[model samples]
Target: MDAPRQDAWKDEEDLLLATTVLKHIREGKTQLEAFQEVAEQLHRTPAACGFRWNATVRKEYQKEIQDAKNSRKATRTIYSSSKSSDDTPMSLDAAISFLKEMKTKQFEDYGKENLETQLKKLNEDNEKLREELKQWEAAWNEMDKLVHWVREKRKSESGV
Candidate 1:
């Protein structure tokens, strides 16, 4: 009646999970979305991922989380102060445009990060392929040498 062992999180997985959670927070999206995405990538349950993030990863990034919260609070204060002074709220169009701009910027930043990750993975794959090719080449050369040795032995045995 022993319990099964769970897989440990690697550094790369932890980094990705942390980044995804931070991105979702910046975008004002639910943590569930981040958890689901990380879970799918890491082949873990969303609940497990979420629990790990809250229990461990979140604490590690306390400064980052606090900074984001402070930045948001400052933005809200600025907006509130402006509204109070003007006695008028931001127009619907202006608010929508601002939101659209923020979304676009977030998307661009995310895309850049994704590209960098992909490039790193591709570079690693390329290095692995090169090593495999070198091994194959060495194997082929050894086989060729063996074939030549066998042919020479047969010729000498046949007196040719």
Candidate 2:
């Protein structure tokens, strides 16, 4: 008897898995919790989801995961150390400043990616235009030669 094949992971599932894991980590929750949540949504076993995340998805999103961890740690440290009202506001200000900086950087990175994609598309378009121009030039050269040949043949046949 043939064994049933396992279902392949979709891109959306991978994305959801990664984000859920990151969310759990940032909240100081366990991987098992994240796996359970993802499993319910994806209709897979929690163990299977955990294995997939640990083996592949986590590696692919290591940088993002680390960033989330660092952000959460910084927020925790700021809140925990603030005792007085003045210190509380100062810590809040620092957190706000950090958030603004992150937002700005995210926008800058997005803009750079957009520009690179546009540049690549424009280069492709320019190459296509160059090829078309070469074809048109060849056709014009052939027509010019034919026109000259006909004129000489007419003159010779007319004894001019």
Local distance difference test values of all predictions, in order: 0.80, 0.83
Candidate 1 weakest ten by summed lDDT? 73-82
User: lDDT tens string, model 1, 20-130?
Assistant: 887666544578999999999999999999999988889999888777667545544554343556545654534554577678878999999999999999999999999
> Candidate 2, which segments miss by more than 4 Å at Cα?
1-6, 83-160
Residue 70 displacement (Å), model 2: 0.3
- Can you tell me which runs of candidate 1 are displaced by over 4 Å? 1-6, 72-160
For each candidate, what TM-score against the reference? 0.43, 0.49
Q: What residue pairs clash in candidate 1, if any at all?
A: none
TM-score of 1: 0.43
Local accuracy of candidate 2 as per-residue lDDT tens digits, 56-97: 899899899998889777765665453534534544445665
